[model samples]
Target: MYRIPFDRVNWTTSSFLIGTALIALFGLPVYLYHYGANWFLVALFFFYLIATMMSITVGYHRLFSHLAFKAKLPVRVFTLIFGACAFENACLDWASDHRRHHKHVDHDGDPYDISKGFMWAHIGWLMFKLNPEPPMDNVNDLRKDKWVMWQYRYVHWIGLVVGLIIPSALGYAWNAYHGLDPWIGALGGFLIPGIARIVVAQHCTFFINSLCHTVGRQPYSTSHSARDSAVMAFLTFGEGYHNYHHEFQHDYRNGVKAWQWDPSKWTIWTLSKLGLADSLRRVPDSKILLAEMREARRKAELHLEEIRQQQQPGQCQRASDKVHELVEKLAANYHELENAIAERVQLSREALNRWQNETRGIMREISRIQLLTPA
Candidate 1:
């Protein structure tokens, strides 16, 4: 029999996850049965969910892991608290693993390489030390931040207090004031939002690893297992644009197009305006356009080749006609896009947004043209 390596097991994490899961399964249902749907606490669950998830997505993932922008002390502290509440890990640990994931994605060295399978990437990697120890060398910059380090030292206790104790205390007080059993409020507020919320949050974060790789289009680069799923983006607060993310990991925005939903990007932008964020990084439109156009051309060529190898002569001719049309239109689109980007003036945020939308329009038109000559 293969003996369990007890030393290698992250007992603290394993016990917490199992304890919370059992509460979410057994405790939450019991509380709901007794309270008959405390919509108020349910709303609080969602509130905590959004807050903590954003802390991880915007604060930890983007701000800390990628250093996509610089945040003020308050902003950094805010992210650290709620990020701890997310209970994934300390910001240092989380960012280190994530940086490795980016540096060596879809490879054995990738912390959550999707090649291992969906479940493994989503949660199995966390079941044990399946991933190698993340090198601290990758996150030397984050370590320099005092707030990040403070949170690192007290992360577990911070998670318990901010994620559980506080909510439970408030719930108990509210219920006792209303002359109801304090335990009822405690259960609904603490267990549901505290434990259950972690489960839901973990999955939202996990979806970025699993669903992002499994379902979606790779418009920027197919060099890795990443892809952009708009549906997943909405679910994960805009982290689902994995294809663009993998292609341009340093870019501040995953949903680069103006029309896409990316609350995380918007939050960073908003903070900058409020002077709580600064030094926001962005990939120039010219570079983004270049990558998209190249990928489109590659796909078109592959499709044409597949069509050419087929037996149907009539189908072959039709496909050839469509391919030619696609190639011609794509070249035109590329030139127009390049010209627009080159002639751009002092671009304000609104101008930048408008420019992105127009670029997206041209890309969409190219897509329509490609469909006209379907393989």
Candidate 2:
């Protein structure tokens, strides 16, 4: 177990994290029992939840951290405002840590390195100031953005007012207009939409660092701990395709597939259409396919080698022969696939399609061999 450094404890962050969670846990049930699910309050909570979570995932993570897309002032302002409400940190600090995380992922510099432990990655890192404060020199580009600087100067004030006070005021007004107790309504709003939403939204982001690195499929690359999870995507508004995100960090979309639930990707696309965003970076389909093929080929080769090693000298001659044939086939097809892609600029569409089809068939065969291999 990792020891908590009492002297290194960040009292402010620790208090906020623990206090908000405790209030949400204990206060929410009491609020529900008294108010019996007031629709206005419930709607407010959902509204805050979606806004804050989206701001962090889309704005702080994608726009600021990775520079995945360029946003107009309105989009930037909105994201920064609610992104602050998530209370993760100012854009400058958040982006700085995130850039370091990618530049030195899973190594000493990663702010929330999962190798440390699930709890450490999830929240312990934030609770305690175990490491010395690193300079924000990485965010030189962001430092030029006036809006980001403005938010950095007053993030906590914005968070307190827009995140908590505004919701409470709205709740009070709603109750007053409806001839109900405004005081109770205000308290309910502060507790539910304000505090509880923060706890949930913050955890959703933390899960990307903890659970994303711990479980899920790493089809793209195992070089890093990052993996993809549909459940995490759902919780985080489509930020859960961690494997793909790590593999192609500059791509605007985490969920790279057509059917993947990446609302952040969709939002950026929609913003582009509306002239609110532009310069959305994306990894080409060919490149993505190449990555998949390479990983698949590598896994197949490992499985085949294992099967060959396991085969008795003469007892499993047939299986050994089959493994050799599959290995030859895999190598030949993969080589051809690479050549075809390399000459894609000069190749006709028809020829590329034929090569792709042949490669897919080879991959299917490789998959079968992999499945047959004993765990």
Candidate 3:
């Protein structure tokens, strides 16, 4: 690998990340032959993955970046600790970069601009310094958070302690209890959940940047690279609904539907029920309906535009009657499309009304219960 003079490759970041890749690639095969993995180590792999991942999805990304919902101090602390263990960056830095990504998207100032290519967006942006100067001006809101700021100030030390040291210690302890040699246990901890887990987890985040944008449907917004993808949601733990996230950035839910794979949304809601989170943000159904209608309209218009281009004056000059027939058919189809669009909007409006009525009934019931109970 060629090193550039101006590239602000933070050696701390590059060394650990690159070292992990090397370990996962070369070290894993050697280690597996010698000690082999046990059920306990396998369990650690999943446990740490979920714990650290939620710290980013629920903590660093949504809670800090978008402020989709308010969390209790304990929740924040939990997320902060696990989030640091993920080793992406400081909470402030991650949130600041995310806010900029949303604000600029594929245009200038987007740190991971997909326009540069999928590889670039996925991981290259981190390896090389694209913006040169870090943008502190964007995240003024997060600055007010004492915990977030403190995390940013000591993120490097935090990463070292929480990310590597703790996992390694836990691995050694687990192995020691099983009567295995201390060195083998230490090696297992350092490699399995420590390095391998980080490698896999980091790529999941990268997939959101690369695959989520490249592969999904943009039912919510075609103006950006973001798209809605269920496969991605499965892999990235519900961050795959990029289209909705880009369109409704403030909404606490990524997978808004009942069946959508959004564990993050579930976590936030569960915490809210426990009084650990509150003011969960949700976009109104009416707004979502309107966006759907707009998208349908855009699709129809695009189809019409393609037809218009194909039927240029010179292309149809030899077949006047055919052109007239096509025109009549198109006119009818256009009218039908218009009517369909209207009907879709009407159906959505009715559904929204029904939902609202149901919500009101629930609220009233809750209010009655509250009134009956003494504070």
lDDT of each: 0.82, 0.86, 0.78
Candidate 1 per-residue lDDT, tens place, 1-375, comes to 967566667777678777878888888888777676566677878889999999999998998899899889888898999999999989999998898899889998888889988977987678778546655798888778888899999998999999999888878887898899998788677877788899889889989999999999998888898999899999999998999998988878989888888999999999999999999999987668667876776776666566566635444365456666666666666666667667874445675455455546544544454222324
On TM-score, the leading prediction is: 2
For model 2, the superposed segments whose C-alpha errors exceed 4 Å read 344-364, 367-375
Evaluate residue 95 in candidate 2 and report its C-alpha lDDT on the 0 to 100 scale: 94
The per-residue C-alpha lDDT of model 2 at residue 139 equals: 95
Question: What does candidate 2 score on TM?
Answer: 0.93
Ranking by TM-score: 2, 1, 3
- The sequence of per-residue lDDT tens digits that candidate 3 reaches over residues 248-299 is 9999999987899999999999999999999999986766645655564455
The candidate that wins on lDDT is 2
RMSD (Cα, Å) of model 2: 2.7
What C-alpha RMSD separates each model from the true structure? 4.2, 2.7, 12.4
Clashing pairs in 2: none
